[model samples]
Target chain A: MDRINVCIIGSGNWATTIARNVGRNVANSQHMEPIVYMYVYEEIVDGRKLTEIINTTHINVKYMPDFVLPTNIVAVDDVVKTARDADILIFAIPPTFVNSCCKTLLGKVKPTAHAVSLIKGFERGDDGQIVLISQIIMRQLKIPCSVLVGCNLAHEIANDNFVEGTIGCRDQKYFRLLQDIFKSATFRVVVTDDADCVEICSTLRNVIAFGAGCADGMELNENTKAGIIRRGFLETLQFVDVFYPGCRMATFFEACGISDLVTSCYANRNRKLAEAFVKTGQPLSELEHILIPGHEPLGPVTAELVHIMLEKKGLADKFPLFTVIYKICVGDQPLTRLVETLRFAREDM
Target chain B: MDRINVCIIGSGNWATTIARNVGRNVANSQHMEPIVYMYVYEEIVDGRKLTEIINTTHINVKYMPDFVLPTNIVAVDDVVKTARDADILIFAIPPTFVNSCCKTLLGKVKPTAHAVSLIKGFERGDDGQIVLISQIIMRQLKIPCSVLVGCNLAHEIANDNFVEGTIGCRDQKYFRLLQDIFKSATFRVVVTDDADCVEICSTLRNVIAFGAGCADGMELNENTKAGIIRRGFLETLQFVDVFYPGCRMATFFEACGISDLVTSCYANRNRKLAEAFVKTGQPLSELEHILIPGHEPLGPVTAELVHIMLEKKGLADKFPLFTVIYKICVGDQPLTRLVETLRFAREDM
Candidate 1:
């Protein structure tokens, strides 16, 4: 059999950082193809197209500035052109682009090609239900779509720091291929069959970051901050049990679960923005403009989305932290009294 | 039943800090007595007896200065005197004092009385086996002993910031009593039937804090820090499963398990000292003298104790993080390469 052709379907900072892992691992793997085709959205940076810059210089100069990607990795401008011949597709684009991108590649790519989405938030369906990005890809392209998520910070991974992550794949054959394609000395990969739990944990972590940021912004005790995080995790666990059932409790112990939540809570744009929102008494949008211009923090946005789903299901009170996060984001709840909010909110599970 | 008579053992900062919770809870509790007797080892603080200062001023001057304990918390220097008529004994003294203190209270307290140890470290039995402090209390005094552990930082609780804890009570009747004694608006109490896991989590948290502190000290990125804490918790989960079997994975989700670990990792003397050990090339004792002056950090000490037991049982390699921590403390392993140690150690179960 021919070696597995790998295609990375995004060129953002995370995508570029992960392309380093995927592109480099192909050098040593016997079962993976040598050339990795990375899809970079056509953009002009400094009078050069982004794809041309990445392909000629072996660096994602615009998204991931200084670090170099593997030499064998080729860059392509058209999404369909890059994905058409691949057997393993890695989706790391903004979650909003997943549906359209998958639609573009629907009949273009091999039906045997499976996907692993690194997208980190939920997309809403026409029925107003939350949909996993991998599900959208699988539904559009008729292929198995697993997910990869964990405490992997792009800059840290770029610097070659130790990182661990989980791959949620169901098939044993694909698991070994993925393990061979992504595992490196610094990047440890653990794969589980609970794909939905992996994606949900990645999505809900941003919401928990809001609570952790509020705790930090209020200068509440470490006890309260830790309690909010624990309670948020408990609520997420219950949310999985209620809506996305049949996942094991052990899945919550993986890198995609508690590790991702802890990393986001401690240090992330969302937590930082939430902290600024508390300290400056400004709306999240205003804080985003001032603190991190041009980029929006997703904590408050995800909070609103999760809140909408919970409210529609008539279970808003079931997740007090998530509800309170949305309330605080919208100024519906006074921030001053929330120093003890999660403490009194019955753990919300 | 008549109101439960309460005796608090030890009058250190934590003891005095917790006395505030016990004393305040009594005001709203019908099952508890109005007065609490706290044991204070005889000492002179600034020309006044420590017990006299607490009894007269409603404050523990040497231990918890400037904070007024509830007036109903009376202080006495005699251990047996405090325990003689009590029905709920709160043992918050240092672990070194547990054996002798329990021996003194043997056959002196009411036969119906029970214990709840606030100790955070392990005790070694005659065979060098690690023993829970509650086990020693029960063995010495022939009374049932439960435990209370969580992210309850003493100063934070004293300042009236929100706090949460778990009461590892096996008996439903005692659970209600403990729930009454520890619960407050700011002090939320969660009770679990798995007392042994709760106690083990409390004890092993110190060992994990060393890994966290080491990560921070080395200036490793947030991804690595979160990974270390997660791996440490994973090792602790496996540790519980091996020696103290039959505990649920759900118990580790409680305040005593992950919350306590997070709190200690982010902010505690053990974490602080471990960071200092990495920054300063001096020994732990030298760093303790410079930073904390009179008190010793327990993380390294507990690491050594746990290492001894694991070595005796031939399970040293099964806990890579714990073993590396002990090796780092004893200078058997270079601290530098540990940046990638746990990452490559196969998640040793």
Candidate 2:
């Protein structure tokens, strides 16, 4: 069999972590390329190009500075040059960068390449439908794109901590191949055929994590917090049922679903920002500026998009928690009223 | 409609919390008895019978001292007299005492009564089958039995913090009645028609909590802890599939299953003691003596019984987590090998 050439299309902390895994795995295997090309977007960092610094120091100084990357991961600045002739393309860029990056590699990627998206947010199409990053990548590149999602905190994975991720792919051959590339002693991967479910779950869990944060900021007891998380989970299930009709309910039990939601609710920036929103009585935009400067809190944005989608589909009434979250984030409702909102929301259930 | 007389057949912390909900709900409604009789095994506290003290002070000072019981919840001593004409029996006693309590009230409980078991542990039959507490109640009293289980921490519930519990009942009438009695502004109930699944999840979750504790004791990373929990959950699903064939897969998503497991793994005494076991290298019995005084850590006992049952059916190999947890608790295996054991366990998956 011909060796599979792997390329990573991002240079963030998560992207570097993926490159570390792929670079190490490929170096140890005879059936894959020993070198991994990482698209770096050509940034200057402290008198040198970021890609040059990464290739020289084997560290991502901006995002993930503590861990050392595998030596074989060569960083490239040009997207088309980086992705050209690759058999596997791993997308780990921010959601905002995906479209422009894909435009640069529209027809440059190998026709037989299999893509796996690690992007965590969704986009709204012109028709007002929520578009998965995988769908966007597939639409742009004319290749089958799957999703890799779970409670994978990059720092944890970098520390060689035990973690599990779900790969949502339709092709069994790609599933096994991706699993082989990603699965290590510490990082385990499970595959399912519901790519849309995986992507949707990864995108929507931030909203639920925000709800958990709101509960925590209110100083609610553990039971109440657990109740909010559970309610958020059920609402997500209901939303997926109504919006993504063919997604199996059991997919919600997988790593990309409940596990990711649990982790995000307990430990994530979204939860922290929402908690700050409740504690300080400030809007999410201000909270994001203070807590996570220059980065958008995806929860509120996703909640707004979800609100629009639900309104178009006449599902606003069906998802009261999501609606209330959007209202709270947008300053239409006070955070103090969250408990009562959840109470009223549960009554509908 | 005839008024339903509710009798709570235990006077522990959880029982007091249940009586608090029932007492308040019944007092506010005309369809049920305003007075709730809670059977307390006669014990002397400060030279007075425990039941007498509860009736006078409205507190289970021994078990739960922080919260006051409702005024209308009268305490009784005689098992038969307590449940004599009751239309709803809430069993909150430990499994060890259930048979003797059932024996004393075998012929006295009202034949038309419906029962809900709040018992957390399971019983092993003479033939080595896992006996659900509800099954035992149904056999002893010839009444339809259901279960109330969830992430309900007793003190939190008593403090009037918001919480949710699942009622697993095959009878719709009993489900509605139980929901009415238990539901409040702070305490909510969702009903499912899978009583066995509910009971088994509540019982088996202690084992999973022990696994969580073991992970905590070993100082595994959060990702590892989450993986153990997810794997434990899947194993429980597999166990339910084999032992209780008709249980719905969706039942595992309910409050009784994932919610309860999450809470127990996070905060319960079983998880704490198991963590101590790994930290101090002491057996659970010794740790229980120091940590919980006289109470048995039900996780290990349930694990033992589950182990024997699985061995009898030659299915022990199917549940490696449970087997390894049992072995770890019994000193047959070291706690540090937990990650490796879990790794081997997932290979079979």
Candidate 3:
């Protein structure tokens, strides 16, 4: 076995916690380089540069103040410099920033290098359709890309609580190495060949969680909320089956699918925001500004983008949950229609 | 389209709520007889016979005094008399009483009749393994049996709130008839051909829910609870796949699977009791007596039976959540071991 170099491509809340894991795992494992390069955007925090602060204190002081990073995780201000010598690149930036980040490292990276995406939402494509972040990374860098997604809460995982993640690698050749890089005593990993299916679920689950939030806003019974979530999952199944024809249905059973979906429905920020949106009778714009200033939850964002493609395909009526969530977010429809739309939709389906 | 008679074989909490749906659906469905007979064990409530009270007031005053049964549902004291003239016999009794109810109706049921079971737990078979209640009904009555199960709460559905149910009917010929007898505007139904898988999920999910309950009892983080649930569900998949092959993986995504499991873990008696068991340090026996006397949650009951079979098969370690939950229930292990056992079970599994 040859030494493998790993580089992390972001410095947000999720990225910093994952860096601690990647750094510690690489250090203890044989035939893997100890130094993990993490690309941090240039930021001034409390009269010091963020990258400089991390390099000295080994802590992501701005994003995750409580979590201490591994000493081997070196912070680099330049994206190209961080990824230039790496054998494995981890793209953990937000979905909206994936394209620019990919472009910066396009020709500088090794041609033999492989990439794995931990991005959770979708990016709007040039054709006005939603595109997976892994697809963007692969298309830009000309390398094979895999995905990792699950019920991971950054603060929880950073605190050494147990978390389960699914690695969707279409190639069996990448399984052992990816597993070694990600799996730990508290972080469990499962590999699946259904890459596209796993990635799509990460994007669609937020829309469903938003719907669950509206139900909570109305204080519906447990049975009714569960019923609404069930229908939303079915619609997600239909959406993926129709668009990604070759994706396996069984992949939806993986940690990236139902596990992530249910966890988000229960505790995701989207659920809280949507609940406030309905209960306070305030638009999402106002609620986002008040509750989480300048930060928009992924549910309404994904719903809006997904609704575009659904309408273009002339199938908006078939996906009632997404449509209702998108409409409610934009003030086009009332939140109460979620239950009615789900009930009147094809029960025999 | 000959007139079809529908018989409900119990008057318990869930049975009474379902009888309300079965009664109304039978009345509006064409070619179905307007009369629905429900078998009720004779009991005196407030010095009045329970069956006579149901017949007079169209309500099971003892079991579900708040729900109003449709007028067409006539209550009968004799189980045999209630099912003898029926074309579609519905078994809604608890798993423990399924055998006796089947024995009473064995020779009296119409030769051409089929049955549908709404039972949610498993009974110990003569061979010391857990047996699906639906299988017992089918074998004893000499008729094909389907199943209806989901995230249904008795009071929730009885109040006309929306609910989703999965009907695992392997026979396409019986789909139309079963759908007509069960589906309503508020009670939605979806049919799956994986009959045994659906039936086993109704049993195995209880064990998983018990694990979730134990996780809740510890006040573990939401991510950890979801991961435990995800692993418990995977164990459930492996349990069904190893013991009962030919079960589709996609069926686990249905209402009978994840929807019901999440709902139960969130609000079912099992989760509540387990929480009490941990917080108060009292054994389940004492807790059940103090909280709801004479009522035992299905989670531990099913866990005890499933553990026997798993241990007999020499694969107890593979299903750590079930084993831990069972051990915790019977005082063989402390509840604190739940988290440590889960963390050390199998990270790369």
Candidate 4:
């Protein structure tokens, strides 16, 4: 078997985690049949002083180091030069930089290379389509690609903890290859050919995380949280089925969707930031700057998602959690009212 | 439509709450409909004190109240002498006493009466079946019936708050009749034709609530509690399907299952008591003897259910949360472990 060479673009937390996990697997193999190369594109921040205020993560070149990084890497610079020679190229850049980054890396990367995406958000428009990070790259580059996403990334890399996620690709070979390459004791992965399902699951997983964060910020009990996750599941299902059908509903039997939704809502830093902002009545812009700049703004994406459900889909009555989350995000409602609505809806359900 | 007459049997806190809520609805109604008749079965408890409890509850009874002496209320008692004309007969007695209570109520109440059960637990043995309170009555008396259950009665009535719940029957006419009878803005009730689902939802709601008590006993988090409720949903779907395959799985989509589970796990007093015992590291037997005898002993039922799931079903590997919750109940694991397992299983999902 030709060793699969997996190259990741961006030195973000997600990018670093996948590289470390995959690289370690290849290095530890007794026979070393297939060599994996991880290319990290670290942007030059003035004086390397960005870490002074926020904090910088160390990437482990040792591959599976006891402390930081966790991967053997042949790190590279500049998107065009590094991605030119790779079998599989993964884009883990923040959604905000997706368009510009795609423009720079498109033709330089292998034309037939499997393009994998991990970005999540909805591009603003009259018809507002949910855009996968891979789709954004492929559209700009004029190439076809697949996506791999779900719940395991930052915590897995930063905390050296075990986490499970899903891989999605329309191509069977790429899906299987990615699944086999990434599967490990600590990092379990499931492969699916349902791009739409994977796309929706990946996208809403973050959106719902914001809702879960609101639930957490309120210190609501399990019953309320369970209802929130379930309702979130239904909301995603409704939106996906309305906009893009035939995607296998990935969460019908799986724990990743519901559990991940809960985790994101409660523990995810991005969501926690949003929740804190809402709780303290901070300005939306201040909170927006803190969260992962998903597409335009995290709060608006969430608000618009809820708005679409109510206005377009007419599902506001069915999913009070979605509406509550929207109201909380926009500061239109208090947490108690959200809880009351949820309770009222629960009574009605 | 004819006003439905409701007769409640048993005088525990649960039974009293149901009676009180129903009484409140009747008192506040524009017309005298769904008139509630509360019955206290005291053949087991000494007669005098049971009377005292009944009298105390009567202090605020806005509706007409009836008290039948213990001996005369037996099956041998004239069928019409006590509840000859009642419409709905509620079995609110403890699970252990339900079988005998059914024998006593059999033929004594109206043959056409609709049955509403409030008990929560299963009859353990070769059958290993959830002997629903109504089922025991129907089986013993060979009568057809419906059931109403889900939320904890104390939370609904004593707390003077709305607790989400469901009413289930095989017939639509009976379902609607019960719906109209219990319809209140505050006492929200969702109706379904899923007898098996409601029975399973109600019983498992208690079992999980008991588990929640265990979680709270040790001071677990929203994450751990969320995990338990999620697992509770899975275990519920599993157990209900195993026992009653034809039941509509959509019932899991209702508040009675998900929302009810949350309240049972987070807000119920029984779980609070169990949490206290767990925090103090008291023996389960001692705990049970002190606080569990009068009611259905749902706390112990939850513990036993956890044992069955872990030791007998061998589902710990697949549903790791169950394993962690099992340890929590048995004192072998910390509540933190339960939270960790929940967080991981979710990440894994």
Candidate 5:
């Protein structure tokens, strides 16, 4: 096999963290090149091009300010140029930008290149079906796409704190290669063959985190928070089974499943925003704007998508936790109904 | 078909909470008698018999102060008299006392009686086999046994905070009856048939909680703490499959499994002591003596039993988390090795 070239297709906090991991590994790895190209969507940072600042200072000052990127990681403003001749493509951009970014990479990347999506959340198709971010990348770029998901907080990963991530890939060879690129002493990786299950779990956990935040905002006890999370987990499994059957039950036990959900519920932007939504009686949009400026909070939006999908299948009633979160977000129901809805739903189950 | 007479075989905090639940429910339930008998090991409280004080004041002032027992619950000093003629028995005392309590009820209890164990630890047999507390009760009293386990912190349940518990019973008929006794609006119960799995999970969780506390005391980040918990859960499942095959995977999804484990790791006496052990370098015995006097911290002791059981089978290496916890508690290993042991163990897996 020829030496592999690696490219990260986003310049966000998570993307920067991935760059650090890959950049460090690729330096000594015989299978890949030392240089890692990160696609930077050219913005002005401190009176300089963001890409230039990243290249010169070896830092993603805008998104991940404190962490220093490895010197081997190069920044490219053009998506096509960044992805050109790359053997490994890592997609860590927001789901909203995946389509546009994939369009730029269309027919530019090598045919043999394999991709791993660090992107979470889903996109709505023309027929109103949920499309995973990885699916979009694979469809547009005509390449095999795997996914990585877990309880990883990007800052913690950047700081070299111990964490575990799950890689969901069908191809065992690619899975091993991806594991080599990402896994470190502190950043451990586990692989599974159920990509769809892992991706779906990653998307749905934001909604669960929203519910956990509501519990926190309402001053509900830890037991109630845990109950909501546990129920949310069961519902996530059920949703995957109903929509994407044949996924293994053990997949939900992986880092992509219960571990990620637990971390998001206890600590995350979604949980924080939802807690503020209940405590301040403010809209989620306003809180998102204040808490995480210029970023779309995925939980409420994903809840809306899930609500629509469940309704389309005439199974809205079966997913009360997701439905209640969607309703509360859209002002169709009061926030106070969150815990009661979950409790009653469990009884019905 | 007959009215069930209820008896509680302990007067500790948990037993008091169960008594309150049954006492309240039985009063309005046609299937059970309103009068509930509680076996109280005789003690002097404020110059009066503990049983007399409980009967007169409707409060277990010594064990569960600030919570009132239902007036219909009558306390008895004699264990045999408490067990006599009772159609339903609940064993909520510590495992150390289970043998003596069951010995007293050996032939005195009616054969028609059914029992559920709210006990949370294990006993070792002569040949070093691990024994479920329910097994002891069943062998001694000749009755069907079911188990209840979950994140029901007694104080939380007593305060009417919402929580869920799982009942594992193979007998569907007895399952429904036990649910009726335990379930309330705030304290919801879910039933499964994997009684042994549930019992094993309940017993092993204390050891996991100790590991979690060691992580906290070592000042590991939340992600690492969550990592330890997730690993502990996987080990729990593996332990059950190795020791008790034919247990359904879905059983771990129930409240008795994941929910209980999460609760114990986050907030419990064992976790607290283990945290202190790491922080102060004190033996578990001294810490338990100071922190929770008269109670053997079940996690360390359970770890010892699990270690013995696993060592007996020559499979001790398979469960590093359990082994390391037991070693730390027994002064065989240093406290600092806990996280590294868990991390390396995952790699080996």
Candidate 6:
């Protein structure tokens, strides 16, 4: 393999991480250094600020400090000139801005680039669709590019730390090529061909994160967290299985599925939203007003998605915990009272 | 299943739990009304103390108050004379005095009694002899009996809270017989014929508890603790697999193996040993000498046993962690340095 030039857009945490990990694989293959170009939006494009943020990250502090952008990293005031001839393009912007950003990039479309998405939230609009970032990219560019998404923790990746994640794309050659470019001593890359399962898993996990945040904000320990997370995965798999019968439910033994849910919900910023509710004794509406780009919406959206799916498929009886969380997040019910009622529901299971 | 009369020998935290869980079943079972007796060494034990000790103990406080010793319970002074014959007998005595205590009951031992043990320690002689509690019992009684042991927490059992435990015996009939008697809504009982695996798992766990406590005393968190526990399991299982081959390696996945190691090492009295060492700056040897009945020695003896077995078989390479721990504990080495070296050693594995 010759030198692989990797381009990352929206130079945020996850974006910085993929660049760092891919960049460190310089010596992994013969006669090659994966040269990574991070395109920072001019507003936050100060190279020093980017370096500070990247350096402050544990992943950078530990594994990929060398991959930190140089003082000469390109500050793109012009979007067209920024993505002129990218090879491996990535959309690492937040979901809300991704559609508009993709439109901005469509005019300067790098026709032959293979794209990967790192954005997390679902795009909400008039129809209120749970559109994935990859789908949005395809809609804008009129190109079928592969999607790569999984439980890639920013702190772990930034720390040059490795975590298990699935790199799923329909194109085997594209998947292997990406895997080889990203693989390092600590970083692990798992390949899969199921795009639907991968997308559903990536998007739906945030909903479970809402449930996990609720559990953690409540100070329920690992046992209760385990129960909640296990139920969430069951619901997730059940939903995904309807769309893709070949999807395998994660055995609780493999901490990846539930562990990922717990980390996103409790240890990360999403959990802080639920913690705010418990601490302030306020409701979700109040929270949404206060938290600009509030993490609370994932809860209601996930509850709605799971509820609509369960109701449509008539599988409500299978996941009692999901049903209760769905009711609590989206219904007219008081959470305190619902918690009291659902406490007994888990006793039988 | 018939309601079986169950009796525990100690008034310690664990003994009371066995009584409470079994007693509830006896009360509800149509076959027989259960009788639970806490053989308190102290007369008129304070219920408040018991409650404080067992925060949310499951058996009704009203049913068995501190002042009111149930008819089923006979004080130690009156146990030999007034105690009614029981179908199932549980010896929950402290392992330290088990031999002497069992010697007293030798003549009173019932032929049909199904005995179980909840102790997790080994006895060592001054000249360097090690004996397991069950081995002592077999030698004293001149008859074989079944035993149940594993990673069981007392507080949960006291409140009739659900937990997973292992039941092991040479005879499957005896193991299942004891299993049926203790099986209740809150208790999960898995019966196995491999006593050696159960013994190795239960004992080796305490040694890792010391390791965990040492880490916690030094201010480590989940990631570090988890790594030590995982490696420690491999170390313990190396010896266990040698002694008991048929026992599934996945048995380490049970609450007794990993979860118990985590809690006992980081959160319990076993871990508290590290606090004394760090706070007082007391030498471990001096501290161990002072706290003669230290539960700390439980794993040490098992460590020695493992070391001896490995040395004899020349299979020391199979378990590097065990070898390091055993050498550190017995040698005139600096405790802190030894612990630091172990943590570093684990990264390579």
Best by DockQ: 1
lDDT of 4 by residue, A254-325 (tens): 434544554565566556765676577786677666664543445447556656745676666666766766
- Give the Å error, residue B265, model 2: 1.6
Best by lDDT: 5
Off by over 4 Å in 6: A17-34, A42-87, A95-266, A275-280, A288-314, A331-349, B1-3, B37-72, B77-84, B96-108, B121-153, B156-266, B269-294, B297-349
| DockQ, each predicted model | 0.71, 0.52, 0.55, 0.23, 0.57, 0.10
Per-model TM-score on C-alpha atoms? 0.96, 0.95, 0.91, 0.77, 0.96, 0.67
Write model 2 residue lDDT over A155-265, tens digit each, in one string: 878888778788999898787789888877878788899878888988888988888898888888777666667777888888888888899866877788777877887
TM-score of 3: 0.91
Lowest summed lDDT window (length 10), candidate 4 chain A: A49-58
Error of 3 at B255 (Å): 1.9
Model number with the top TM-score? 5
Worst 10 residues of 2 chain A by lDDT: A340-349
Residue B296, candidate 3: C-alpha displacement in angstroms:
3.7
Question: DockQ for the candidate 5 complex?
Answer: 0.57
lDDT of candidate model 2 versus the reference: 0.84
lDDT of 4 by residue, B1-349 (tens): 5655656666666666666556655555554443455564433233434444444445312122342222212221122333556776666667787666666667777677767777766566443433566666677766666777765645333543444567887878776556655555555567888887887677666656666676666554444454466666777776676557788756876766755665566666567666867777776667666765545456556555645644565554655655665566677877667545644564222
Q: What docking tier does model 4 reach?
A: acceptable
CAPRI grade of model 2: medium
Residue A276, candidate 1: alpha-carbon lDDT: 89
Q: Rank candidates by TM-score, best first.
A: 5, 1, 2, 3, 4, 6
Q: What C-alpha RMSD separates each model from the true structure?
A: 2.0, 2.1, 2.9, 6.5, 1.8, 7.4
* Residue-by-residue lDDT tens digits, candidate 3, B246-269: 998778777788778788878777
Residues B1-349 of candidate 6: C-alpha lDDT, one tens digit per residue: 5455666666665665566555555566666545554444443335454432323343324323342223343334334331245455567777877787666667675656555777767676453434566777766754464566643455554444334566767776676557656665556666766665676677777767666666566664333344455557566666666766777644554445544554455445545664555556666667766654534455455667767767877776666666665665565445555334433443222
Stretches of candidate 1 off by over 4 Å are A293-296, A336-340, A347-349, B28-31, B293-296, B347-349
Instruction: Itemize residue pairs with steric clashes in candidate 2.
Output: none
Error of 2 at B41 (Å): 2.1
